[model samples]
Target chain A: MYRQPVSRLWWLKKRTYFVFVMRELSCIFVAWFAVFLMVMVFAIGRGEASYQRFMDWAASPVVVAINIVALAFLVLHTMTWFVLTAHATPIRVGGRRVLAMREARVAGRIVPAATAVRVGGRQVPAAMVIASQYAGLVVVSAFIAWLVLR
Target chain B: MTKRHIEPIVWLLFSAGGVAAAVFLPILILLFGLAIPLGWVRPDYNYLDAVVSHWLTRLVLLGLLVVMLFHSAHRFRYTLHDGLQLRWEVPIAVLSYGGALLGSAAALLIVLTI
Candidate 1:
């Protein structure tokens, strides 16, 4: 039996798929943050001097660049995951639901449009879902930014 | 218990960890990596030490480390399988999860001793 080789750039076929692959790719940065946390803990445990040294290392330009880049990816990861989570976690306010139909489509479940509407309760618009997602992201990112820059 | 039996529990941990990391980690990183370094907010060492050494704080820290590592393990395992197309499933799974367990243990010890 012969199997066709999947293209390396298969993800480029769709924007959603690309975003998903990027989401998976962002796990590396997540792990990097975990490692960074471990280092911080170890340094703090070693006392003030080591902690100061760790801070110095973290302050280096290269590290700052890395952190900035990591921050972007982390935001993407968080936003995408929340959107996916929103699909599973239904929230009703004033009898209105903000359903992420994109997630259902992403799952590749051949659900009828009517079924999707029924699942979400009155077909929440895609724009509304995206808007809410970005709104949440902005609030979160702002809080963190304030903590950092204030 | 079979693999299927344990998979759901592990996935639940991974999901919880992901949520926690998403909610908490960005702030921590910003504070330590940027704010402190850039002198935006100068928190004294004594204050930080006291906070880290507090029993409740250490417990919470330990919890975050453990679950975050588990999240890393699950994600890394799938990354290898799905992203890199690595066919060696068993070794990768064991190494990823085992490394996470060891990392959690080490973090626990460090927190306890601190």
Candidate 2:
């Protein structure tokens, strides 16, 4: 069977493809965060001196710069993931699916009465799903902050 | 007996991990990586130590670590396959999942000991 030759740099050919690759690459940063948490926990388990040493290493310029970059990629990952979720998961409420339907309106005497009859057919919107994800993020972050900062 | 497919199991972990990481990692990273280290948010060692040593806290941390690692592994496996065009599927799967397992074991040890 014949096939089109794919370039090694195929991801760079288009903006969306580049972004997709970057999103995939963001997993590295996610893994880094997991490792970082593990190390932090290990240090905390050791002693005050070990924890302080870990903090000192973390405060170094190199580590800080790496984390800043990682943070940017992670935010991108979060936003894209949430947006994708809205499309992938069809949320249901009271046996109704959230849909992108427009409200029917009567124009004039020529307009059909059937258009106006569907007024009470209310449905949830996809935007609500996206908004709720952001709200959940805020709540989780706030809880973590309260736990740590308080 | 019929054989069970592993794709759905790993995919479920990947999806859950993505949600867990999305909602949780940013704040933790912002605090521990940037804010506290840069002196923006002062951390009390005693308070933090006590919190880390808490059984509930350790349990939560273990869960996060395991899921996040598996999530990373699943994503990275695809990144290698599709992004880098690495055709070694079995080795990649073994390496990725194996690494996540190792990380989870390490997390279990650290959290349990702590």
Candidate 3:
């Protein structure tokens, strides 16, 4: 399908690319996040001591490298993901979406800023607003941590 | 679906998933904290292996991967077209769908293998 010319480019700038980079590189976390289970499978397949050794080695510096990579990306992804909540965020259980129209409008603007900032753009209002949303995400995540951890 | 219905559905799934991951993160940390003192959750043991062992966990993993994949797809796709001025629409579409597919596969495989 020959589509019409698009107006903006998302992956071209620093801030915009931050989210893009976060998204593309996020695979590392999903891969490594599941590593424990993967190692478990490996350990179970091999035997007990080998599993223990694997766990130890997995916790080693090199493994930590993998984990740090995984963890950092996970945080990046989480932040990026949470950042989406302001606009793209919805509250739907039983498939009934409860997000109002204004929330949807905000989400529409914010979600693309992740891309907009990348293409040599200046949307300060959008950025500030989104940053505030991130503030909310931090608060919410903290609250969530409190709730979940407690 | 009309625009009203369509957008809400997307945003709803998107928000829900983000919150889900947000919720899961701390829980996972706590799980780790407990597993440490308890000793039964030994690092030597394959906990990841155990998650995949349960069919429910497997499905949950798959759901998380797929939902987030679609959410990201919806995200990255629009950003590329509207924000990135990328002319190549096919690749973006392919990747968006492909990510979901591959994510589903990886999630399922990890589970089934265990």
Candidates' chain A TM-scores: 0.61, 0.79, 0.48
Candidate 2, B1-114: lDDT as tens digits? 112367656766887788888999999999998998888988788899999999999999999899989989988987887777777978988899999999999999999998
Each candidate's DockQ: 0.36, 0.43, 0.20
Among these predictions, the greatest lDDT belongs to 2
Of 2 and 3, which scores higher on TM-score? 2
On the 0 to 100 scale, the lDDT of residue A5 in model 1 is 59
lDDT of 1 by residue, A19-101 (tens): 87788777677767777877887898899999999999999999888888887777777777666555554444345444333
Model 2 residue B12 lDDT score:
66
List pairs with backbone clashes in candidate 2. Answer: none
- Model 2 per-residue lDDT tens digits across residues A1-150: 996656778899899988989988889999998999899989988998999899899999999998998899899889988886775554555543333322222111121111111223443476997899999999999999999999
In candidate 3, what are the lDDT values of residues B1-114, reduced to their tens digit? Answer: 123445555655544455444444433433332333234354424543454456775576557655655555555666565555566877876776566567556656655665
Report model 2's chain A TM-score. Answer: 0.79
Lowest-sum lDDT 10-residue window in model 1 chain B: B1-10
Candidates in descending TM-score order:
2, 1, 3
**C-alpha DockQ for predicted model 3:** 0.20
Q: For candidate 3, what is the DockQ-based docking class?
A: incorrect
Candidate 2: segments with Cα more than 4 A from true spot: A95-123, B1-4
